[model samples]
Every structure is written in structure tokens, then in C-alpha cells.
Target: MTATTVRAVLFDTFGTVVDWRSGIASAFDTVAARHSSRLDSVHLADAWRRRYAPSMQRITSGDRPYTDLDTLHRENLTSVLAEFELPFETSEADVYDLVHAWHELAPWPDSVPGLHALKAQYTIGPLSNGHTALLLEMAKSAGLPWDLIIGSDLTQAYKPDPAAYLRPAAILGLAPAEVMLVAAHNDDLRAARDSGLATAFVARPLEHGSDQSIDLEAESDWDVVADDIVHLAELLHPRLAR
Candidate 1:
């Protein structure tokens, strides 16, 4: 793709830009300490996260009506607590506040600097399954430096859907090829590629929690696959002397 043609870089948020599991686990540790002395923070965090995809699939497959990420998270949390037989009691307001922990996720060490470098040359933003409010809060909390936020709420469709990849390009007044979806997951890149957008993969090997098995390497030939986001920025913007 031509330099002028590539106007924006859209990113997958959770595993791509932020370490959601670690961030959430940290938050759970803090909250659980305040809520109950007996709480097993790591177990709670893991159980809740394990429910995320299935919750989203319920909406995606029409098994359940559409709900925002916060609501879905709360539903999962309730089930997880019940399954674990945690004795702590929580109000709806408490659950709501807890679910918002997702909005405050910490960016990976290279994320802010790399995104800043790329933003100097391209319109940078997120294209994620997160809700618009959640994305905005995440940006503010983590200093993500995005030009816009495109979430599933915008298209009512999730990633791997061609519309989800192409809609952002349309909204940015560019052709499909003019946008690049930068992600850590090969499946996300594959979807972007199939939708005619350029693809960049920045490896985040520890994304899937400690015993991560998938996405250890790129499975397909992406336009670019870098060791990390810093390398990705360098590839996207070469240093040219005056």
C-alpha cells in the first residue's frame, strides 16, 4: 500500500494494545482485598475472563440479545462467583463498578511509545469488541493516544466480520486498503486482510495468561510482523535525515 493511501491504523484492543488479564487480575486483587479476606483473587480473575468470549458469542450468535461489555462482564462475574462459592455479597452498584475495571487496563510497556511513534505518521485508533465508552475510558486511563474509537457498538458486529474491519475505513473516508489493522492475534489480522485492509502483527506472546498456548507466532504472512510495537512503529515510519 502507498504511504499516502494508508490514512489510519486500527488496533484490536484487549490483547493487542493492553495486557487485559494482568490488568484485570491486579484490579481484582485490589478489590477483593477490600471485599473479603478469603477471596482468591487470581482464581476469580481467571474464571471471569474465561467467560468473556462465550458471553460475546451469545450476542454474536443471537442466542442472547446485544448488551454492552460492562453488562456482559457483570453477568460473567456473577456466574463465576456463584461457581466458586465465594461468600462475599455484592450489590448491583458494586458489580457495575467492578466491571468497569476493564476500562482501566494497563497498556503494555511498548504500547504507548510505539503508538505515539506511529501516530506521528498515521491516524491511529481502536477497532475493538469493546463498547465506545469503554474504549474511550481505556484510552484516558492508559494514555492510548487514539484519534477515534470504533467499537462493536458502532457496527453492531464483532471482529472477524468483514463489516467490522471495513466500516472503520469507510468512516475515515478511505478505501479498505488505506487502513491497517494492527493486532497481536493472527486471526484478527487474517480478518483484516480478508476485508482488504493492510495487516500488521505485533507479537504479544504472554497475552493469553501464563500458560498461553495460541498465537505464539504468526500463522500467515501479514504485511508486517514485528517483535513488538516499537519495531512495528519503526517499520511503519523509517527515519529519514533532513
Candidate 2:
């Protein structure tokens, strides 16, 4: 939403702007069909996300050097296959296709339209952990018209890290307060706030699928809260609220 001081806004892409669960799960559709494999796509998708925290922690703890999400996703694909006792020796092409699923993510129903409305008033883009190439591909495929994409690969630091928020603002020639972070996850907003950036929390109840237990509602008194990105656009552009 538009704020008196906010000149631009950045979104947390995974859950906030796109549905990763369904996107990743559906990737297995091709995998199973092509390989005649019995794939539990939903379970595999969940299992892959379950590894997200640990994978990022490795970088955060200095146990592993910083890497792009594409690299992380590749390692995750191999790991999840092992975790699920699926055949890991499948064709490398299949592995690559599955790993590239991040580029095929579909935006929420409100995402494209809301982004259009917001972009008309304020500079809008995504600040996500996704690699630049992945974000670019998704934007092209999903019809998301972003001004630019910024995140971990740019700063070599992932979200919750102050760099993730601060570096982007600095790059934009903006003070932290001049840039707002719109995310469905509270921890993301908390980190943004802690970094001096404004925060907006939008509910993404099904982001993690049926078992989703987090970010079903706003957990903090963020600068704004809306049911979806479209509602967030309306809140920001009061003229459109009519």
C-alpha cells in the first residue's frame, strides 16, 4: 500500500507473490508422466520446503558459502529425492527441468493486477531470495511487470539478514523507511521492520498447502494488512479503493 513516506515497495516472492507449493508440486507431474514413476508430488514439495530453513542456516552460520537459490534448489532436489526414497539417478535432464520449476511459478490471482496498480503509483519489484535469472523467468512467464528484482544473490545474503533489506534500499537510493516490504510471513516483516524498512503483512493461508500453520493472518501491527495483493493495492491506492 502507498504510504506518506514510502516511495517504493518490495515483495517477498515465494509465498507473498507466488504459490511455490503448487508450482513445485506440479513439476512432478511431468516427472511422473515422463518417467512412469510414482511420484508423491505434494509430499515431495513439502519435504523440499522443510529443508529450506536448514539450507539457509548453513549459509547464515558460515558453515557454507553463500549460493544462489538455483544452487540451493538443485541440492534440495537431490536431497528430497533421497529423503523420499525416490530414484535419484534419473536423467540429468529431468533433474534440471525439475530444478528449474522455480521459474515456472504462477502468481496469485491478485498478483499481476495488484502489481500493475501499485506500479502505476510507486516503484514496485520483488525482494526475494530467488536468483535473478529465476525471478526474471517467472516474471516473464507469470506476466508480472516488476520494475526490478532484488534479493539474496544480489547482496549474497538471504532474508532475515539485515543486508537483504538494507542493501536493496541503498541500491535504490532510498532510505529504509522510504521502502516498504510487503510479505505474508510475519518473520519477514519483522526483519524488514528491524532493518528500518516499513512492513505490510498479507495473509497467504494456503501457501504451504493444507497443513499451512503460519502467516494465516497478520501477527504484528504492520503498516498495512490486506486479504490479498489486490486488497493491498486498494489500500495503497485509495483512489482505486472505490
Which candidate gets the maximum TM-score versus the true structure? Answer: 2
**For residues 1-242, could you state the per-residue lDDT of candidate 1 as single tens digits?**
65566789889999889998887777766666767655666667778888988888777787876688888888899898678865667666667667888999999998898888888888999989898999999999999999889887887877676788888888888899999988998888988999999988888888876688889888898888888877887777676111
State the C-alpha lDDT per candidate. Answer: 0.83, 0.87
- Give per-model TM-scores: 0.92, 0.95
Highest-lDDT candidate = 2
Ten-residue segment with the worst summed lDDT in candidate 2? 81-90
**Model 2: per-residue Cα lDDT over 1-242, one tens digit each:** 23878999899999889999999889987788787776889888888888887788888777888998888888988888776776535778888988899898999998988898888889999988887888999999999999988757888888788988999999999999999999999998999999999999888898987788877889879999999888888888787663
Task: Give me the runs in candidate 2 sitting further than 4 Å from their true place.
Answer: 87-89
Candidate 1 yields a Cα-based lDDT of 0.83
Question: How close to the true structure is residue 199 of candidate 2, measured as C-alpha lDDT?
Answer: 91
